[model samples]
Target: MKSTLNKTDEVNGTIVIELEKADYQENVDKSLNQFRQRANIPGFRQGKVPKSLIQKLYGKAVKADEINKIVTDEVGNFIRDNKLKILGEPLPDNSDEKLVDLENDEILKFYFDVALTPEFDLPLDKSVELTCHKVLLEENLLDEQMDAYKKNYGTYLSVEDEAKDTDLIKGTLTELSDSEDKDNLQVIENAILMPSYIKDEEIKSSFTGSKAGDKVVFNPKKAYDNNEAEIASLLQTTKDKVKNIDSDFSLEIKEVTRYQEAEMNQELFDRVLGEGVVTTEEEFRTRIKSELEKQFKPNADHLFIHEARDIIVEKMKEVKFPDEFLKRWLLETGENRTSEQVEDDYPKILEDLKFHIAKQKIAEENNISVEFADIEALAAEVAKAQFAQYGMTNLPADVLQNYTKSMLEKEETVQNLYDKATEDKIIDWLKENVTVIEKEISSKEFNDLMNERTRLQEEN
Candidate 1:
């Protein structure tokens, strides 16, 4: 057997593999012997069939199987021996014919088109500056977040006074119309509504000072913005009948519900801060600030990656790609996709591929590696978050262990965790090697910068 690579350029090549009969005859002979031992025929007992008989019955099949095994092994070995920085996988050379006479042919030739990755050096130095945005937690923003927390944890109280915009009114709705026919008349009873929906300002104003026995009149459909079905249900009538009925209706307020603000005391603090984590209000506020900072770390990290990518793009030039070879390779390998569709996405794919290769090179230069333990740790954090999402905040030790084990056991879950760890490691390497310029900017400015960066990346 002879294997050779013909290089057309730095980023394009062809791998040619020529196999002789001797390359697979030994394996073919072994397979035939095994088949002979297992062969069952009319005249021969099991394990006693003649080799010639077995060959006559299954020679073609055995030969084909042996050739397949040889191809698989030789292809992998050839790629490894040549140290090919391949993109995706090798595509079969389109010019090669598929038909081959295994019985008569002494040599079988297989051709494949290979896309080689262009070699590039890492340009990591003080020359490349990446801006890192530091998010500062303002007091007003913290207060707003606190207000939201209070609202979420607020208690509902049954009030005996008039319904207000913030108050929920419980009452029965009755639909009335000019039609005297009892079947034609529509009525909806026992419906709850908020007085804020009333279109008539005077009627809505009346609801603010009115008590439970007071009644307010307004058009149900008009008040609810043409919500006929909702009006029908509220007025105890069919949706079709609601259109025929008078749009106006009277709401008799039976009860008023008000929300009571939660007290920001020890109990609230304990609930949010894991029981005695912060003893005093000052300490609690400080902890909240710290937590906000930590939460913003991921956003900052994302921006850092964007900036690093831009710096790399700016510093590095002359990225050579075998576009014609890659496009052909993509068209050939993508089974269900058309060449036109592949071509449409080729630019974005090439950019992403270049960035990935560049980052990989950077990681290699910095000796960055993600260990198995790091992946396991990340998997556990993901599992914990998933459990927390299902309202299981305080999971038992055994249950947490079991959950993490089961999560890591999943093929896709483990792969996702591994990829995340690898990205993190690469990002860390970039942060260390590249010069980062810290910038203080408003959240809005930060968002704009990110959007502009994304636009630039997409445009390329």
Candidate 2:
């Protein structure tokens, strides 16, 4: 068998596979023999069918299968042997070939179209400069975090004073009678409500400053803005049942629970920062500022990578791609798009494709790789970050392990974790070799910069 690649240019080519009769004749015979052993005929026992009769019965089908196998193997071998950098999977050649005369000809030929990766020079040195911002923890941000930690660790205390908006009110809700019969009222015992969460300001204020045993009448539908879940929970009924409830209900306050921030003592310190991490209030505040700074690293790294990508894309704008082949590929590969639609969407696709090409080249040049452990570690990190978003920091290791394990069980999640791990490793390497200019900026300024960046992208 002889196979060869005919290239029109750097980004387009055709692979021609020529298969000799000898290459497939043996397999055809083996297949025929197997068929003969399994054949059931009217006047012949199994395994007693003659080879000539078998060939006559199944010769063309066996020949076609053998030729297909040979052509596929030959095409693949040619690509691997030549180390061809391909853009997408090879497609059947556009021009149809008439079938080879299987009975007389001793050779069969097949043709396939292929797209090659665009050639471009990659720079992985200090020449690529990026400005990275150091987010300074402002006083208000730190204070907010401190307040959150204190409140999150706080306990609810029963108060005899009037109920505030932030206080949790425990009460019994009863449907008020429209007529003079008070005995016909429907009641729910031990209902819970927080005045601050009530949607209507007028209704929320009515409950505010109400002491124990104080009864307030309000329409449940208006108080919660017709929120089905809230109304159902308030009346201890199902959402389906809430649809018909349009009456005013009386909520008699049974108990008012006020939440107070935890004191900055040794126990609070131990709980917030782990045991013995900090001893005093000053130490705790300082450590919190530092922790906030560390927490912002992922955001900073994201911006840095974006900066590098913008620079790289601008520098490689003149590089050419195989427009014809790419357009054809977009139309194929299970995408339900017309040629015109593909043309309209091709620019954005090309931009991302160019960046991916650059990233892959850098990874290949540096021998960067992602192992299973890398994926697992990234999963754990992501789980922790999500937990921290909810202010549940420093979770037990076993709990994190369980989350990571569950995440890896999903195919999509595993793919995302793999991508995140690869990006992190590549960025880490880039920071060491690239020129990263660090500049301190306030959180507000950083946010404004991000907003401006987003605006510019939208305009483009």
Candidate 3:
């Protein structure tokens, strides 16, 4: 057997592998013998089947299998031995596969196309300048966040005064009836109503400024604009049960509940940030400011990446790839993807591939790694974010650890954690090594800049 590579350029090449019958004859013979021993024909006993019959029956298949295994092993070994820096995997030349004739051919030849990664040193050292925006914790922003916390910790209280539109009115719903049947006068005891939800101005006005114990009579269908779902929810019944009935209901306001915002005290801090985390209002405000800054770091990092990508891609434009070979490989590997689709998506794919290559090079050169501890930490951050979405900002350490551990048990979750950690490490490294010009900007300005960048990207 003889194998050699022919290079067309630094980033593209082909390899030709020539093999004689000796390459696979021994393996083919051994396979045929094994088949003969396992054979159980009608006229022959097991282990006594003739080699000639076995060879005639399964000769081509066994030979093909052996040759294929030999070719795969040879190619893999050659790549490793040569320390080749390849991009996509080596593809079979001209076709996806070949069927060789062992009966007539004394020798066989195969061709495989290979691509090498284009080499370019990125200008990503201390000379590279990037701007990292620090969002100012403006007074209004802090006040807005404080309001959300107050609402979350607010208490419901009964109101003896006039009914307000936003207030919750709890009362008894008594269905009025014109007929003699008492059963038809359906009364849902302890039913709650929020008059603000009434669509009709005339019906909603009747409940305004109404004190407790005041009885209000209104047609449900007309108040709700004939929406059975809203009427059924207000009446505490299924939509199907009230789809056709249109009648007036008497609501005797039993109670008016109003939400009272929690005061900025030790109790509020304890509830939001866990017990004893902050005992004073000043400390609570400071902590909130720190958290806001931490949350905004990802956004700032995103903006920096977006700003740096164009510069780096332009710098590395001279680096090339084996475009023809890659297009063929992509079409072959993709699931039901057409040539036209590949053509249209290739430019974006190439840009992303270039960005990834640059990032990977930096990570590899700096010995950046994502350890189990890093992944666990990232999983905890993710778990905390998930809880925050449902109004849970604080959790016990044991409970949070257990939840994150459960998340890491899944393959996909662990992989995502790994990716996130690696990216964070890379961002940190870039911030440290590159010239980062710290900029203080209001939240509005930061958001407008991001929106403008997005618009420009979409335009391009």
Candidate 4:
């Protein structure tokens, strides 16, 4: 067997592998012998087929199979031996068709097109500065959050007074105009309406003083601020028909409901935080601050990563890629869409791929590793947060373990955890070793910057 690579350009190369009869004759013979042992033929007992008969029947197939195996092995070996970081799997060169005749040749020659990875370096030591915002929780923000919490745990009570803007009113909605042509003027019973949605200033004001059993006639469309769906729902009509029908409807109030806010005490804090976690208001506030900080850390880290990527890209602008070779390689890969489509997305793809390779190299240099335990712990944390979102704060140990195990068992979830763990390790290494200048910015400003960055990314 003989193998050689011809470099056509910086990124493009052709690897030719030549296999003589000696390279595959042994495997061919072995395959024929194995076939003979398993052959079933007329006039022959089982496992007693003659070698000559087996060769006549299966020689061509055995030879072809052996050649294919040899070719695949040699291709892989050539790549490894050359230490080539390829973009994708090698494709059979168009020129390979003329190189060898499978019917008569004792030697097989295979040609493949290769795309080499572009060489690049990290720009970590470059003078690049990025602001990392430490979000300071304001008193107003806490109070607003506390109010939301109180409302979430609030008590709903039935009242005899008229519905106010903050009140929920239960009424029987009836349509006055009933014509065979106006099927949309059908009435609905036991519909609940929030007074906040009522549009007419006079009608909204009138609702505050009227008691139960009072019949109020108002335009459904106007009352619901011209919300066609809401009007249709109140008048029992489809949205399309609601526009054609007259908007007048009668609302017979049956009940009025009001909500009383929950008292913030030790019990509330215990339920929000872990049981026995906070015994005082100060402790509760501190816990809230801690939670806010914990949440802010990832956002801050993301901003830093973004700034670092910009810095790296700016410094490494001189690094060049063999775009033509890459485009050809993508066309041959047969994974994504057409080459034109891939080329359209190539800029971002190339940037991400380059950064990923750089990070991997940095990780290797620093001997940074993400442990299986770290991944498992991250998975568990994710599972805990998902449970917490559903108000399941105190999950049993067995239940939590089962949920985490199930999450880790999913192929996508496992890959996500692996990626997160690897990225975290890489980022930690970068933060510790790289010259990062930390500048403070307000939370609102940081959020605006993040939103702007996201908008630009989406546009790209």
Candidate 5:
């Protein structure tokens, strides 16, 4: 068997494989002999069937299979040995091959079309400019974070004053009727309501100054904007029965509960920052500010990376690609993708492909790589962030390690983390090479920048 790569252009080529009868005849004969040994014809005993009969029955099929296997293996070996940088798998060129007389043909020929990777130069230097926006921890932002923590650890307290919008009101609901007959009135005990959640302003205002044992008459359906769910819950009935409740209901206020934020004391500090991390209010605030700075660094780095990518893309805008070949590849390989869909999505796909190629080239030139240890570290960080969302920041080392290990056991998770690590390494390399101008801005300004970026992307 012999294979040769014929270059059609810098980005396209054809691989021609030539197979002589000697290349496949031996394997075909060996397969036929094996088939004869396993033959189960009724007229012949096992291992006693004639070779001539077996050859006549399966000769062409066996020969074709052997030739295909040889051609495939030779094509792959040729590509690998030559260090060919191809885009997608080689596709068979059926148009170049004619019907062969397998019974008498001594040499078989096959053709395959391939797309080669395009080459370009992207040199990273101080010429590339980027801005890294450092988000300053504004007092408002810190106060907001502190307030959230206090609310999470807050307690509910009973009050004897009038019901406020933020207060939870408990009462007994008694349906009122104009007629003297009050035996069939609907009575609901321990009904709960919050003025803040009331849909009607008039009804909500009526409960503002109502203290304990004060009775306020209001229509449940109107107060909740005729919502069946809310009315049913307040009246202790199903949605189907809420429609029958048309009379006004009197709510006798039993108790008003107000939520009070946890005090800035030793216990609060211990619960929030882990035991003994902070002893006083000043220390707690300082530690929280420090934590905010640490958290904000990643956001600044993310923006820096985003800006760097844009600069790279704009610089490499003139790089060429095999447009027709890639479109064909996408249509053929993508599952259930129509030509119209591929055409519509090709621009974005091409942009992403260009960035991917650029990243590969940069990694190769810089000797940057993602190791197993890097992925493990990233996985551990991810687990810590997830746990921290639920206020479990100070976890045991073994617990975090076990969670990270479980995540790495999943193939999809490992692949995702590996990709993230690779991108992160490349970003680090970019930061080292490019000119990054660091500017400190307030949190609101940083948020505005991010929001504007998102808005522009959505518009495009």
Candidate 6:
């Protein structure tokens, strides 16, 4: 067998594989004998089936299969031996019209088309300048975060006085009707209500200064502006059922519960930052500032990387790709994707592909590699960020490690983590090589900058 690559252009090529009968005749004969041993004929025993009969029956199919295997192996070997940087898998040349005639031909030829990656020069040095925004943690921002912690660690108290807008009011809700007969009306016992959620002003005012044992009559549908989900929850029924009821409901108030914010004391600190983590308010504030910085680091890194990508991509404006071949390859490989859809998304796909190629080239030049430990560490950081979203910021190291371990057990999760870890390493390398100007800005300014960038991206 002989396999050779003919370059049609810089980024496109065709590999022709010529095979002789000797290459697959032995495998074909061996398969025929196996089939002969397994055959059950009418006039002959299984092992005694005639070789000629077996050859005639399965020869073409066996020969085609053997030739296909040989072609695939040869193509793979040729690509590896030549160190070709191919874009996608090689496809059968759609323009090639030659058909394999296993019964008549002793030598067969096959054509496969390959798209090679275009090579370009990447200028990676201090010449590339990027701005890194350092978001300043203002005093007011710290106070706001402290207030959130206070609210999260607050206590609920049952009050016996007026029902405030923010108070949780427990009552028995009974539907009122004009008819003297009230037996068929819906009644939800122990129904919880929040006066603040009432959409209608007059209906909400009726609950003002409402104390225990007071009965307030109002239309549930009208009070919430006919919100199906809210009415359903208050009436303890489905949204469909809530639509049928439009009568006034009498709520016999049982108790009013108010959420009281925790005082800025040692106990509050312990609850927010874990046991004995901070003893005084000064220490607590200092620790909170540190935690905020840690939380903001990822965001800052993301912004830096985003800007770095644009800078690097702008420098690579002259890079090229095998556009026509890739379009055909995409149309063939994509599941149930139409040409119109591929055309619509191809530009974005091409841009992403270019960035990917650039990143790979950078990694190759720097000898940057990701290990299991790198992935594990990034996974742990991810786990911490997830838990921090729910105010569980100070989770134990062992707990975070276990969560990360559980996440890495899934193959898809490991792959995703690996990709993220690799990108992070690349970003670090860029930060070291490129000229990064760090500017400390207020949180609001930083947010506005990010929002402006996002708006510009969306417009583009």
User: In every candidate, how many clashes are there?
Assistant: 4, 0, 0, 0, 0, 0
Alpha-carbon lDDT of model 6: 0.87
* lDDT (Cα, tens digit) per residue for candidate 4, span 104-149: 8877778887877667666564354555567766677667667766
Where does candidate 5 stray beyond 4 Å? Answer: 33-42, 45-48, 97-104, 154-262, 265-267, 290-302, 455-460
TM-score against truth, every candidate? 0.69, 0.76, 0.81, 0.68, 0.71, 0.74
Show pairs that collide, candidate 3: none
- In the predicted model 6, the residue pairs found to clash are none
**Cα lDDT tens digits for candidate 1, 113-184:** 788888877667766777777877778867876776577667878888766776777775555556565474
Query: For each candidate, what is the lDDT?
Result: 0.75, 0.86, 0.84, 0.76, 0.85, 0.87
> Which is superior by TM-score, 2 or 4?
2
lDDT of 5 by residue, 139-219 (tens): 987898788878888998999877788898888988999999989998889898888888999999998777788999999
Clashing pairs in 5: none
Q: What is the lDDT of residue 46 in candidate 3?
A: 98
Tens-place lDDT per residue, model 3, 141-252, is 8888888898989898997879888788878888888877878787877877777898999989888888788899989999999898898898788999888888789988
Model 2: per-residue lDDT, tens digit, 1-460? Answer: 8888889988889888777878888998898899999999778998998888888999889888877887888778888999999887888874645446667776766778899998888666888788888999899998999899998999988999989999999988889766887785779889889999999999999999998989999999999999999999888889998898789999888999999788878888888767898898999899888877767778888899888888878877998888788888889974579988888889988878888888888888899999999998888888887887777766777998999899999999999888878888888888899898999988888888888888987987
TM-score of 6: 0.74
Per-residue lDDT over 166-251 for candidate 6, one digit per residue giving the tens place of the 0 to 100 score: 89989898888889997898888899988999999998988878988999999988999999999998988889987788898999
Q: What is the C-alpha RMSD of each candidate to the true structure, in Å?
A: 6.9, 5.0, 4.2, 7.5, 5.8, 5.4
- Which structure among the candidates has the greatest TM-score? 3
Off by over 4 Å in 6: 37-48, 94-99, 157-259, 293-296, 336-346, 452-460
RMSD in Å for candidate 5, one decimal? 5.8
Quickly count the clashes in candidate 5.
0
Model 3 CA deviation exceeding 4 Å by range: 1-9, 16-58, 77-83, 95-103, 118-124, 178-180, 183-185, 244-248, 314-324, 327-351, 386-392, 395-416
